[model samples]
Target: MGVHSVNWEPFLTCAVTGAGDTLSKHPDLPVTPEQIATAAIEAAEAGAAIVHIHVREPATGKGCREVAYYREVVERIRDSGVEVLINLTTGMGGDVVVGDRGGEDTPAPGSDFVGAMERLVHVEQLRPDLCSLDCGSLNFDDDRLVYVMPPAYLRPSAARIRELGVKPEMEVFDLGHVAFASRLVAEGLVEPPALFQLCLGISYGAPSTPAAMVAMRDHLPEGAVWSAFGLGRMEMPMVAQAMLLGGNLRVGLEDNLWLRRGVLASNADLVRRAKAIVEDLGGRLASPKEAADRLGLPPA
Candidate 1:
């Protein structure tokens, strides 16, 4: 892979809430569509050009693939007239857990596996400015659990995402994931100037280190627009590393719960910190209009 230069003018993507079980860890973690929408607005007001979103089961706080929840969140954000670009997640419905016993029951519970088209249902309906396309799957946080997305599923999903006229932000967890995403782009399933998100520091994946970030960035397709994020304490450090490496960066409660050692952070708080870091480093934050034009999305 060739060395890719740094992005002097970078965009910030605040992932308000992810599918993880961070509710108990952070008291203010957004659960319902209303709260999630509110968090997105706050992040936007705090200088995030894009908001990466994942809906949860309102009553349980666990991530869900319900279109109603997504519709509510999208409607709320649009109604609020936030200038930030919306990037809905299609990373749900791919989690799988295995049982000790074999056969049909061996699949075990906590598995939300579904076909490719089923995962993109929400993206097709709302047709937001951007929707994430997890390029590959890997063993989740636990041993028995795995996120499954083979080429069979991704190819069709990418094709459908292209058809919807919504830009696909290819989320890559590791090096292999980046290679696979590049293949999709090579095959024309994804359009030019492909957007990528390097997810690091998750259990069983790439660590949140300069080497890992650079390796992933180096391997990205030529001329690809990309960003990087690390989980937990590494979140803030990765913010600097990503920018230094010439890429945009993401920071939010979804990837981290604390702004410091003990204090919890709101989505806006994280965005504010990231903005400050970018400015201090002599890098400018791109506005939503600037980001949209660079990423080839229609104006909001």
Candidate 2:
């Protein structure tokens, strides 16, 4: 279906905090579990139907894969009585840093590569309504840092997520990732009416542009639900582009740190701004209930 032919009630997703080391870049970035949960609640109140989450180390403000942190954040959001859908990140535990010239077998201090089952520990424990599954590996913004998500790893991870009854939001960074995701759908690994998130404008991924967004949208499986977002300045532009192209929207400090030049933004600020753009364009924002139905998620 072409962009205009598809339905266009935009559902906003506030990616509350990502695994990126942006603590130093922005003073208001949520680090601790309490902070992250508060930001998520505020974003939902500001018009986001879904909140993408990543837990960080409270001490150092670095992203870490700990179930305790995830539990705390999820509990807080649930206890707060917000209606937003929780989408946790399973994209961590895949960082692989190659050592210097002499240390071929030895990985760097930051390298963390574990099995598929180990990576999904938090998802299994918390059982969020949605969780992210990176479709393929790529040079994660730097040559030395590789994000490893081989097909062998993805098959089992997708299966496990399905078994846990959590919808996997397949994260596609490039055309090849989309193809692989299609394979997962074909193999019956991913649930029917597969969902995707087209991630653009990282260091070595697809360029963030209207043409690139359209091309990637075209590559998705038939009737698949998808959302797209870009990094840095392209964040808001892609928000509008995704809505125009018959998909949902995602915005947060995870993708872009600033609302404008010299202005650091909170997740709520980004969602509020995106809500305005969607409304001014004659597109209505989806509520949490509406979003769950559109994305094939069970009632919250």
Best by lDDT: 1
TM-score of each: 0.97, 0.97
Single out the weakest 10-residue window by summed lDDT for candidate 1.
1-10
Deviation (Å) of 170 in candidate 2 = 0.2
RMSD of each: 1.2, 1.3
- lDDT per residue for candidate 1 within 7-104, as digits (tens), equals 77899999999999889898789999999999999999999999999999988999999999999999999999889899999999999888787566
Q: What's the CA error at residue 92 for candidate 1, in Å?
A: 0.8
Each model's backbone clash number = 2, 0
What are the per-residue Cα lDDT tens digits for candidate 2 across 190-288? 987798999999888888999998989898888898999999999999988998888899999999999899989999999989999888788888999
lDDT by candidate, in order shown:
0.92, 0.91
Q: Residue 45 CA error for candidate 2 (Å)? A: 0.4
